[model samples]
Target chain A: MKVQISGLCKKYDGKPVLNIDNLTFEQGRIHVIIGPNGSGKSTLVNIISGLEKADHGTVAYGSNQKRFEEVRGSITLVMQHPYLFNTTVFSNIAYGLRCRGADKKQTELLVKEAAEKVNLSAFLTRKAATLSGGEMQRVALARALVLKPELLLLDEATANLDPESIGIIERVIRDFQTATGATVVFITHNIFQARRIAERVYLMMGGRIIEEGSKEKTFGNPESRITREFLRGELIF
Target chain B: MDNITNGFFGALELILSGNREVYGIIGLSLVVSFVSVIISMFFSVPLGIVIGMNRFPFRKAVIMIINTLMGLPPVIAGLVVYLLLSRSGPLGYLRMLHTPQAMVIAQVLLVSPIIIGVTLAGVKDRGNLIQKTAFTLGANRCQALWTIIKECRTSIGASLVAGYGRAISEVGAVMLVGGNIKGHTRVMTTAIVLETNMGNFDQAIAIGIVLLVLFFILNILLQKYQGA
Candidate 1:
């Protein structure tokens, strides 16, 4: 889905956090939103996914620009510290399908497929609570992937993950978009990861989009001074 | 020492021999307590989930009131129910006073707050996360709530057990409202009180033993359910 934001404004305790005038993430591409800690990347994705209401803004979805409620089920977000339900990994991965009332046979098929994609088929019967952090994250991702969301939002989804898990997640994300033709908004703190996966890059600072373009243009060519400094690792905070 | 020895043997005999009157008291106690706890669970569990999972006006006040009521004396709850059901009182038209129904009402009032408080405490920490997680996964409001209940089922079970304990061991409210009529509304606790008052120490000890054993068995069952 093509997501468009306009006149967006948000505040925390009367202190402005996000104030984006206009931003659009094109459909069927990996758009990496990179920013430092507390830059409101998560907040933006939360608003886009309908998990949070923006203080003053609008988020419209798809070609017809439907409201959030109309497109809610098609959007899914994987959080930074994903919460796996206290149950078997199979149940965790099957949760979204069950919510959509998928029959037992179909749910099992899809859940197994998603788990295999994330290399978690062996862990399906194990308790979710017993998994390591990386395994838990893969389970969370598998669960979201099974739903076949049109708009997939990952808010630092691979944060604190091991190298192997990160490689697996990035590959799975790339594969997911390619196979499903879905829009993937990947929020990350690591610029290198953005360079590796982002077809389009949006650099945010203090809740505002400082610069955005194709990865080659945004990273290699000229852009905002702040973006340059951020790329060079000199833009502290 | 002799009296204590006799009471122990007499209590075992009373239970094993299945004295009709003693069994009647035990049956009545279970019936009243089970009814009250079941009724209270229907109200308390949902209310607790709602309060624990949301933020609204006077939320702290509502929690404070529930907490206070959790510690509310059984006599006070009985007095309130008695006034409500008495002939001159508001609900007197139903003519439920001095009966098992009245005793059930009183126990419901006494037990509800305990269940609610415990359930609230159980769900408070993880309820929000569970609800939000389910919602993000495409669950409707009811579905999300069902997830919260499932996640916190252990705490909910503990609450039911706590409420059951309060209702079964309760004496003041049942005594005041049930009138302890022999073979009618009399339950184990009230019978024990009556027997002790009449200096039938052996009989009182027997009833006490029955109450303890019954509660212990029920507690084991509840614990097993929680573990499962």
Candidate 2:
């Protein structure tokens, strides 16, 4: 489903955190958002996923037809911090499906499938709280994926992973997107990883979208000085 | 010095011999404190979770009131319950005065706020992470609530210990309400009071020893749980 965010805005303590005029996410595409620290990338993901309410404007899905709450089950967000339940890995992946009342057999099938997708099948009985950072993120990812959401929102999903873990996560995400045709909105400060994964890129600065375009144009020949400085790892503001 | 030494050894012997009175006090104290803690849990866990997780009008006021109530004097709780159950009082028709039921009521009144207050603090401390994760996982309000409570299980365990500790050691409320009746409403604290007053120093020391041991064991459990 297409996601159209129009005039999305949020403020904390009277200071603006996110202000996007208009942005459209195409179905079945990987959209990456890149910016420096404190660029409101996570805030955007939170607003889009309904975890935080936008102060003004609206986020609609499917050709501006459905509001976020109207299409609630279709979007899933994997937060930057791996929020694991104090339970086994199997239960962590099965949590969302169980909340939706999935039967035992179906839950078992989905749990195994998600774990195998993330190569966590061997750790099903392990406590989620005991996993490493990368494993925790994978469990979070598996949880979101098992819901089969149409729109997957990721806030720095691979931010703290080691190189090997990052490669494994990228492979899993690619396979899941290929099989399910799920649209992905991933936020990261890593330009190199963005280049590797994103079909379209959005540059955010000072709580606003400064520039957006296809990866080649935005990365190779950016329009804004902020974008250029960000690519160069130089101070922008 | 002689009285202290004899009382101490006699108390130990009484416990070792499984003296009927000692067993009676132990059993009564356990039953009363356990019942009170169970009732406190039933009421306070849900109240704590609600107050910790939701935002509504007077939420802060309600929390403040509960916290204040946690520091309420045990004697005052006894007086309040006493007034409620006394003859010609509002609940006098039930005629529950000078009974174990009345003592349980006073203990519940004394400890429910403690349970609620401690559980509230625990829930507040852990509510943020659990609520955020649960909401992101598409959990509805009730599911999110249960998730928060489950996450604070260790804290809830601590609250139970604290409540039971307070209820079991309480002497004022049980003495006033249970009336220290021998073999009927008598608990350890009340029995010790009667024994001490009647110059039965051996029995008083025995009960005191038992109370000290119980408190020590509870403290050890609390420390272990906190470490865990």
Chain A only, candidate 1, TM-score: 0.98
DockQ per candidate, 2 decimals: 0.75, 0.70
lDDT of each: 0.91, 0.88
- The collision pairs in model 2 are none
- Name the top TM-score candidate: 1
Q: Considering summed lDDT, which 10 consecutive residues are worst modelled in model 1 chain A?
A: A228-237
Give a tens-digit lDDT track for model 2, residues A1-237: 788889988999899998889989999988999888888988988888887899998888876579877778778888888679889999999999998899999999999999998889999999998899989999999999999988898899898788877888888878778888889998887888889988899999888999899999998999999888878875322
In candidate 2, what are the lDDT values of residues B1-228, reduced to their tens digit? Answer: 888888889888998999997899889999999999998898899888778766789998998999898888888999989999999889999999999899999999999998898888888766877888887777888998888888888778888899999999999999888888888889998888888888878889999998999999999888876666
How many clashes show up per model? 0, 0
Off by over 4 Å in 2: A235-237, B53-68
Per-residue error for B94 in candidate 1, Å, reads: 0.6
